[model samples]
Target: MKAREAVSRVLPATIACLVACAKPQGGGPPRVEIRPSDCAIPSQPLLRGIHSIVAERAMSCAVLDQGQVACWGVQDLGRLGDGFEVKRRDLPTRVPGLQGVVAVTQGNDATFARMADGSVRVWGPNRGGEFGDGSPDYHIAWAPRAVAQWGTIKQIAGGIPTCAIRSDDKVVCAGRARFRRMNEDTAAPGGTPVVVPGLESAAGIAAGSGFTCALLGEGSVWCWGMADAGQLGNGGGEDQDKPVHVRSLDPAVEIDAGSDTACARLAGGGVRCWGRSFAGYGLDHPEKWLRPVEIKGTRDATQISIGDRVGCALLRDSTVACWGESSYDGQLGDGSDETRGTVAGPVACVRDAVQVSVGDNHSCALLRDGTARCWGSGTYGAVGDGTHEIRKIPVAVLDAVEPAPDAERCPPGTTFKRGKGQDDLEAVAEWCETPDGKREGMYVGRWATGQKLQQGGYVSGVRHGEWTRYYEHGEVVSKDRYEHGEPHGVWIAYSLHWRFAFASCFDHGRRVWQVSSEAEANQKRCP
Candidate 1:
């Protein structure tokens, strides 16, 4: 069965169990009857150097213990930064020889990473000089090469093309001048690196699927490139080949972009989103918010990350909330597989969430405790548990570093209260019925002992033919042949409970029935 279908079936039962357990009269959380082997707690040696991170476009990413980065996904033109022209890498491998990386950014197939020295390196498909190497050839740089034109880079952003900002405040870009095409006059003279016109002292840059935006030191925003989806936040559908001011935004500290949407976080910790509502990342309400629409109910948002189908915000309280499509897997972390168009209910897997990142079908959060947990699709081991098992809850990737031990044996007679008893007696009775009449003719005792209570072929309250009595614990308490509910023929009795009160055979409904001399049974009288 498909994972979604399987989850749908199992989730209802699981939810029922949870709801039943939460009731005041009901018991606490149901005991999970998992075997020791099923827990699979790993040894510490296997957890060394495992770094879990998120990337765009369902891409595969790897982060070294020292923070080096490499990624591969949707590389139609070698944009996956693997120094290859292949379509995609189904497996993850290290990027040849790159080190001392602090952060990474990706756009389509091209990738850029910032190093410890504040230098930036880029590779992959560079048809428009988006590789930042002053070349437009579609060649893969197998080794990390420095972008000499831009230095002291604090942050980097890439769209259809690539752009970066230096610590000194200047913005430089390399790639086709598609953003200039919005004016119709400066339609890119082929592919070349050009300084974005008008902007100086940029504090940050954000790149969408096709457009780019920059947060300036003056507390204003500017955008360029594809505007078909209003991703530029310029309140117009026309593309901007050159940088144009986005007057709608206030002084912003951080900005994020998805396939066709852009959002910014204000200094006051309020968030405003624009572009591509159809993708469900723009705003909860309809009407195509060309300008910034304040994200409802989100306050103290310190960090934000946007994906093609979802968005997540890290709050100052160290909590993370997400919204948008969660169908691909547990990407939303709302404890449901259904897609959500609005903000998700809060989740509390960790105490102090420090960093959050969203992928096409997965998400990861770094906690203040230096631990990282991930959820969503694990088809590519994106959850980083060393296994590809998909989880709907945030699972510690480092928790299971070693293989599970052998399965342990359990003693017999282990009875577990699976869940609450339904008030529907008919349903409960039907559950105790067996194919043959063997278990029928049993009476319900004062206490439930897991025994099946069933009636055999009977008329009124009288029992006839073979009649059996069961121990409340599901064991046979006695077996007797009866005529009209009165014991007849051979009768046997057992003990453990009720001490086998009586064992006798009777004619009709009364008279001295043949009685067993068993110590416990003969000591009591029959009713």
Candidate 2:
């Protein structure tokens, strides 16, 4: 099953877990639509010095060299962990209040940040007890919160129900227990994290929408959860409520699970996959495999990732080869969108690729240079570019480093012009104003879709008057005053629903006061 289809199937249960919450925010840029395509920037790089990369349904995040976490794409339900108020960012924004983050992963709309200290922090939609916070309430976790008192976590994987590997090599899971993947016939109250019975000394674990798999210390593999798609690889179509060993597969090193399929890297550098065989197990004809089957045309595969329908392998030569459902969104990254094929080939412009991650419609590759690139579906910023446009080839994920000299060059109304300090990363050589070469006036920028995306007054390339950010749907998301490029006076952030989320006062560049969803307090403070 495709990840999108899996999401829709699980949506009802997710929505049932949600609860209302207060809002919070402050004004900054023009509002983009909260929709999949509206909130992205155009052709931007998102992260730098990336040590690891993780991809979810339509979002991607990375862990930097120093354990800092950055994520972009699909900020709904606070999945990005930047904050709840941010709809989406095409470029990666560092997840706040975290350090020493060794790894990251995601469920449908949630993120798990694993710290070096062996503790885990989780955020985003808490539906079906995926947050593992021992709470039954459904809500968006605007920030990373501790997963109750659990700690000593070594590895973590996210899914409809997230799972983790503790220091003792025991596996623990939290989330919906419908498939009994949690190993207990009856789920613990409040989705508390619990040990998977009789499972220990595991080397790695992978979580899927409704299943989990583990690579044991002895190089054996075990799986549980819904096996209707043959994902369990136990030579049967029946579901297993507890971990069951698969015959004829041992010495496995790594494993990954998709919506309805799973893949493993063997001790000999080959990859084998089973489940929803239409996705391809290296055969000319799409057929389901009840047991592990080697993916043809692949060898020396150091790493592998499975998308909803597509799959990719990172060969030892640092190139990527993708197959299955390649046309769904250029997920194959071969420059053309072919509907579906069993033939795996090299991805365009992907070299020195150390790690690869595949999402529902897109995929990303982390290079040895510590930079990241993505291709395929960009709708929802899945490609990590700043726009909703689809990419036919790899594009750099905007990094925090200095942008290219031309990056600041704005279009028409906000065109970039030569100016002093133009080379400085903080310099805004571009200004927003009348298009007739006018220097002193307000400027407006509009999208090709014909909606105004930005409007603010400027003087000599510097903002110097009232600025308001609007949502792509025409609702105002923020209002603030600026004095010569610096924020001043009242700053307000509005939720996508047009509700007051946060209010703040800025003097020059420093904040005077801030309140979370307390519009009255902000009004009085600003007044």
Candidate 3:
């Protein structure tokens, strides 16, 4: 990038140092910026496959297809969940102890995950009881741990004193969460998740800077907590300790709350937001709009997410659009740093997205093919491509995978790897080659981050034995047995949280039966 800049006054050694330092570090591939004319989506069948993503200011987290969570960015306050050994990670690192995760939420100082079994896990500071574990408020979590005993939780909303929605559509909050459990004046239970009075049939929840909002089954919205910037949506500057009805909001199917701002995706696929804005969908100005205002051109939004004074929506046609504040630091992913007023526009150079998450200075989109792309500031590795640079356009979250040259890299009758570095040495995948330069014995593939992707065994030059694919967190994706490169025996596929998904029995490369539930697989036998 510096090659195009005017540096005639620089010394030769200094210039060389600048050029050398710009090279990819930590086993990352060479940087290549995608241009608008020929932007192509990169394929990453092994390392990508991110199902959903959640982001805060400098940190971002995504759920892999196997229900494992990978997080990166600033590791401050133990938010990265790998402890304080490193200041930051420029690549996605698995969050230890988290498996079968279906949802994730990031608070200002902590993070939360809801498991497939309807339980919840949390990490980071317990400041204000955000962990919901009933621990000391000053406790700082160095690893993931279970939350307070509660009912089956469907979702978790991150904030000071996080909140959750149970399978019964009842809302309960933990930590410094202040909703009344009994009456309007009764305070919410601290250190445990307490039910929020008057909130039932809740479908989704959003935790804001100092407030919270919920989307009910009937499409109505309710909010509580600090409302100085019209966060309560009641046209008042007063604070609320109990659930309060929000006015003028169209029946919404989804809701998101950010610093002094909140948004909702209407039943008809339109987007409306309220809070700090002089006019239009929303803005960062002091005058707070107490009522929701519709943003034009977002009538096709299927999902809505907002950050500090910024917002983005995943549209029905698999595209993403952004508005509010400026596209500062390229967070809007529109191919430029052009500042905007209230006009909304589509994000360029990426498509087929199922979900989009907006952070303060960056955004990430989970594509339909199970891969992901991120844009804007790469500081703290929020971009997840093993870099710390600003990107105006969308970039792949995974590095490309390729095989090593057999003649030079693979040694006969010995374990072979890509490199001798520390990260490479720990790679779970290694293989051996026959004297004639054909792969033999164990075969496994790993991502650049040194996580096992897939593993299988081979006899001579043909595939044999059991083969298994894994997520970044080491959860099994699929398991199957093969004989002489043909499918044989039982083959099984697991979904989020390692839950039994699909199973099929085969005999000598022939299908016998397939089942969706574990009971059926147990009763049927391949003949």
State the local distance difference test value for candidate 3: 0.61
Q: Rank the candidates by TM-score, best first.
A: 2, 3, 1
Q: Candidate 2 — which residues are off by over 4 angstroms? A: 1-46, 178-187, 278-284, 339-342, 400-527
Runs with alpha carbons beyond 4 Å of true place in candidate 3: 1-34, 37-46, 177-189, 278-286, 399-527
> Number of the top candidate by TM-score?
2
In model 2, the worst 10-residue window by lDDT is: 6-15
Which runs in model 1 stand beyond 4 Å of their true positions?
Answer: 1-54, 60-67, 70-96, 180-192, 278-287, 387-390, 398-527
Q: Give the least accurate 10-residue stretch of model 1, judged by summed lDDT.
A: 1-10
Write the residue-wise lDDT of candidate 2 on 339-376 in tens digits. 33344566666667778888877888777667667888
Q: Model 3 clash pairs?
A: 49-370, 100-497, 129-175
* Candidate 3, 1-527: lDDT as tens digits: 00000000111111000001121212222333445443554444324656777767787887775677777777766677743224566667666556688777787668777777888777767777666766536766655667656668877777755777888999877766455433455444466677887888988888877788888988899988888888888878898887788866657788887777888888876778877762324244436768787776688888778877668888788778777655357776665555433445677666677778887778887766666678888897778776788877777776322334444333346444322112222222333445554432322221111222224211111112122222212333222232311244665544324544446564533445656567887787766
Can you write out model 1's per-residue Cα lDDT over 122-240, one digit (the tens) per residue?
A: 66556566766656666554334567755677777766667777776777666664455433444334344456767878887777666778889867888887788777777888977
TM-score of 3: 0.67
Ranking 2 against 3 by TM-score, winner: 2
User: Using alpha carbons, what is the TM-score of model 1?
Assistant: 0.60
Give all candidates' CA lDDT scores. 0.51, 0.61, 0.61
